[model samples]
Target: MPSNVHSEEEWARLQPHITKLYSDEAKSLKEVMEAMERGYDFHATPRMYKHRLQKWGLDKKYKEKEVIHMSLLKKQREALGKRSIFFVRGKEVDWEQIEKYLHRRPDLKTKIRAGMLKMSSDSFDIVCRSPSPDPILHASNTLQYTDELLRLLDGYYVSSLSECPSGKRVNKVRDYAAAIRCFRRLDQARTMILANMLEPGFLALNKSLDDLKFVVRDQDATLIFYLCDVVTIFDQRHSPLVVELLRHTYGILQITFGESHPLVWLLRRLILLPEIDRYEVIATVVKAAVDKFERPGVDDRVIERLKCHYFLLLDHMASKGIKTTASFPEMDATSMDAVSVAYLGRFADRLVHSCKFEEAERKSDLMLPWLQNTANRQHAAWPDLQLFYLHVKAHGAFTRGDNKVGEAWLATVDQHAGRYFPNM
Candidate 1:
């Protein structure tokens, strides 16, 4: 069948005629459509015309008005579909009715199993209010039952990621992350939480990320690194259960270069996409048209945005008291380029501000040596890179009450001497 696409003028012309036939004369949609085709220049099919009516909000005006007619079956289905896990009936939930409904509609299982469906209240209080046997929902072992729920949830989250189609799973990954965020909140839903039982799979605390690496497709895989990297958000030895859970899932994400740690190696290929571009990898066709030639579009802004993102993550690490190492353990890894060095400089600079005198001094110590190596190789010493190296050292000196050392570095910055900053 041909497209029912009509020009604005044609649609404008047809509207009055359709309104009169359907509402004024009380003709059925099919009768109105037939009249339209016979009298007006309506070339589209009845289904297409009906679709247009719905799209344009015309059908609702002409729809036959009636009372709020919610039948018994409708009420049953609505209650069943409202929450993922609900009570059966009476004081306790009976699984029989809903279980039968789920048996008939397998699609609900697909959504729930894929982590798209979240639980309403973990547990709800349902009472029949009438004289029915008090069928309260009670488990033999509450702790064990909660553990089983967590395991079941964990299985769904993992399966959801695995089931996502490759090369088209951008939103799925983000949606899964959203699901993870919800799952993360579950630790606080109840006072008594089983830390060990709910962790590793359902909610990883500070475990190895070897399992979920395969689930990450495209740039979203980098989220796994962020999830596992050296994050000092909380001390591994936090006193509370909630803090401990946060500590494990978001590990200490310290930035370092070497194959010994997967950070730099992963960063090498993990394409840095801005939060707005989160779903870009899905496909251009899938998204509404993004003007390629628009001012400061994706191309003009990507690098700087990526730099900002790295700077923020690094700054966060320092603020959280995550220790930044003075040196990387020797290992073969992807060599740093100008761009990567710039990112490192930005990151180390944040450490200088967020850390104490000694810690900042140590960061400068590592940075200067690394920057020197990078500077010699690149033969490009712009002001930003030079400032990063000098500012940290000068701050360290000033904080240590070493006026002479601080003054010497300050003199070099003010004088702009060729030898002091040879590249400048």
Candidate 2:
């Protein structure tokens, strides 16, 4: 057995391997301890043993370079503003050189540096918390500084990734998310930032969505949903940023989760803005869905559910007095044809339920003419035709106060009712 004099060192040297062993094979710590004891060799010091392990790529040392760099950068920034003639090593210096020096530092001090970077307590408690802060002046200055910092950080992170694609250095995605959260908090700090034209905070939020998209598969869906909810609250209906963010979000959903994913429902809720370019966002989602599920034996239920969702979106638009256009900028003729058929079918069903026979007939006339104009249109079955006929007749009877005729029409509907509308 190895002597107990070096047991602590041995334990430290073996710590990483022991952790890996336990993780890779799900072994108990006690089992790892026993195994290490059984294979003990007493020729070297613990330091030597640790060096050997590290040399063999079996151990790693925790480093804090990023934290240290951030701290020095913040301190330099504060000093440049406070002291008129800042000097370093017998020469006067500027803030830019101080920042460059900090960035090039070998060791980072994370926590201390981050603390230094935080806004002063006096500023937070007095300037930000005051009920009557100069909204326009404060917002203009803060937004300018925040936007410059964000752009600089974005470039830095991108450069770092480009230099080493597989480099397991800093967690850039997590850091970006944190920065976005910081901007969001700042935006919430005052009403001034909310109404500002720069919209630095909202742009940061959109970048957050992009970062989330990059690592969404590894992130919790519930957390993403919550973040999206917060975004909706911040991005009121009139905000133009809402449309751009929704477009990015739609792309994220397409690559990370399929159309049937429940998170898509949350996204759908967020894009319920009347002033937003609805067709643009919806068309992106529809194209993604069609491309993802164009297999030979696709699930019929999934297709139907997607169609139902589009129908509901159209209904919502119509209710808001927004006209539905046949032309979408992003969709081709063939794609538009598929979407139109699905939308019209649902519209007809809704009219049937509302007992609007004349309206249903009018929509059918409008749709049939377009459907016929398409070069390679899909055929509608006789049963489908008869179903609409009976729905129209039922609506006519309901309007005329002929309960007997309405009942007779409903009996025919029952004979043809599928699983979806079984009770109806």
Candidate 3:
């Protein structure tokens, strides 16, 4: 076919071949055109190729600023003794290319290092609490709280270090210990909250009372607490104390780690949830963040996972009788990670709680294959998730007046319980 005289059917027929040549083989336009002409007697103009590539979202080239921003993020991650991999516009960035750009633009490198160049959403400002102490409290009292928190943090750090920690784990323990201590002081809590939401272990579905004992001294159920309890303090949203504590903790995280750090981004979303009252506002924030997520120096999977969590959050609000015109965000669980798969199970439960049993059953039904396929099925939490899903199915069946099906689901749940938790 002539280059300028191609039909829609011809382009459709050639799409796969052209895709393989250009995207899969990473061929230039000239090479792709030459190969197509030589091999398939197909011809296309460069303008057509460029338009198609853009339309297909297969364009691999980055703007100059994007390269510089990605390089800066790489440098920031490496300085924190972490490995950074970048994917922008659906293409993996070459490290050698970033290095070449940095070498040529020494001034840009200096400006990035000095935190002057604003490149992406990865750059965040630290928000500090007001300098003045609360009117009810004295400066000395505030200092006392800070001093006590530091002492506790130091003790935790020492004990954690004594456990034969090495490398990044030690640093993580240290950073989280400081963040925890800051959280305690900001919340004005005499007893320490055992759960740190920032800690990956807290995301486990199988944690029990025994797991929470390390955070508080008392065995009393009343004293053990999670970060959310501290943030909102039992339906006491929009309190000055909550606002102050959240801001202070946010600042502690931002200052301890730079803006582009993964922990900071995680903390940002965590803190954002409680501060914003409206679901619409929260959804907008999430959409914006997800839109810019490609170059935010954060993993795309992590961003999607967070979006799932935000959906769960909004669902929880609606279940609590909060009026909201905003629709919840939908997720494509087919390609989601383990965290997201687990969240889907929770979301199904939320649906059940909302009395949307049919939707709950459908979501729960979709979860089984994803659960089985995920690498997390090997973890201790797997059985717990299984049990939860089975119970959800049983509840949905019972709600729909199908006693036989409900009993069958319960029997399966019991079987799992017997196998996974014999003592219980």
Candidate 4:
């Protein structure tokens, strides 16, 4: 195929696609290029395609400052300045903004007449009492209670996994579905939301991503690592949230900045987490990130960690007395190391919870020496683990009517608490 495939006839064909691309009420060049390639089947170097886009007056949409912000309220404000009505679908919705209309004084009369929408404030204060300080709802300028605003964001929590359009469902069958036809493609919206939605567990939300700052510097890679570290420290490796955040971040960054290696690196780290819905989050992230990278790199430690977790999950299932459906590797129960001890501890918990009294107590006995040795060896290190062992041991003994042994265990913990947890 010739590199210069943009012949006169080709240009005529390409022109329609370019016009459609610009007419799209969309943000993000990555999506535009994808639509051009997949939908239009227009093949060319990125530079050539972009040059053609520029020639067709579509380049302006890709520029950060020039691209329209998708928020409709923002547009109206920019056009009409302040003193404009907070409205929705041509209806005046500012219940409080109506208060300005009550005054009939001359100076206020002519100025108020220029208003497009106005409403009266309610004085029906019926002693609205709350047990605690209501913060978010009462915050001025955030009219969350307004019917119009609620119309847009109502029922946002309709489970994204739901497939059927069910009865009395206030939400779209798909989340934020209204934006797809206007702002970006559903897939593109999904990618962006995943990568950048500043959920609570993610890093500080205040970080600047304007002008593609985060995507350009590959900052989402740092976030992935940070999130992975958090989930590890908190022993939330199997947490769905961690996986969701990673999955979304990877997707969003994939389109925003194509072939991002750092994003893939974080994704591999994420897939290793024990709590992730493996078939969903792992498969999704891996497929998307792999598509972007020619040679997706996998860390050796990540693989090892995954294997350990795989067996750990199996061991856990066995402890619960659930039939192991697969031939899974088992951790040796005889080992006194932390990992093995953890397995023993979980086994004890399962037995106890299932009302297997003697079996649970026996596992506790089996764990005692390992716990004592570990606490004595490095009392300063992993104090939480040590405390957990001691507390469980004492609780187990007390339950079995061995008060003397339980008291001794408590004395040991108190001694350690004074040394290690001085604040307590």
> Highest TM-score: which candidate?
3
Note the Cα lDDT for every prediction shown.
0.38, 0.41, 0.50, 0.39
Q: Can you list the residue pairs that collide in candidate 3?
A: 194-215
- Candidate 2 per-residue C-alpha lDDT over 290-400 given as tens digits, one digit per residue, 9 for 90 to 100: 344444554443344344443444443454344554321121323333334434544554465456767666654544543455452333333333344455455556555
Per-prediction tally of clashes: 13, 7, 1, 8
lDDT of 3 by residue, 1-424 (tens): 3647788788878876786576546688899999989998887788988887676555335444676567666555433323556666555566676665555446766787676876576533312122342324333444444344334333433443325334422222111122222222222121111222212222121133233233332111111113233343312332444444445445644565457543344334444443333233333434443343334444455445445544555454453344444444466757654444455666676576567987887788776776676575675456656666776787677767889998999899779879986764
Q: CA lDDT of 416 in candidate 4?
A: 74
Query: Root-mean-square deviation of each candidate, in angstroms?
Result: 20.7, 20.8, 23.4, 24.3
Which has the better lDDT: candidate 3, or candidate 4? 3
Question: Against the true structure, what is each candidate's TM-score?
Answer: 0.24, 0.23, 0.36, 0.28
lDDT (tens digit, per residue) of candidate 1 on 273-322? 22122112112211111121223423323333233333344344443343
lDDT of 1 at 98: 41
Which residue runs does candidate 2 get wrong by more than 4 Å?
1-315, 321-342, 349-359, 362-396, 399-402, 418-424
| Deviation from native of the Cα of residue 387 in model 4, angstroms | 1.8
User: Can you write out model 4's per-residue Cα lDDT over 360-408, one digit (the tens) per residue?
Assistant: 6776566567556644356322454455456556656665678999899
Error of 3 at 85 (Å): 54
Q: Pick the candidate with the highest lDDT.
A: 3
Error of 1 at 284 (Å): 24
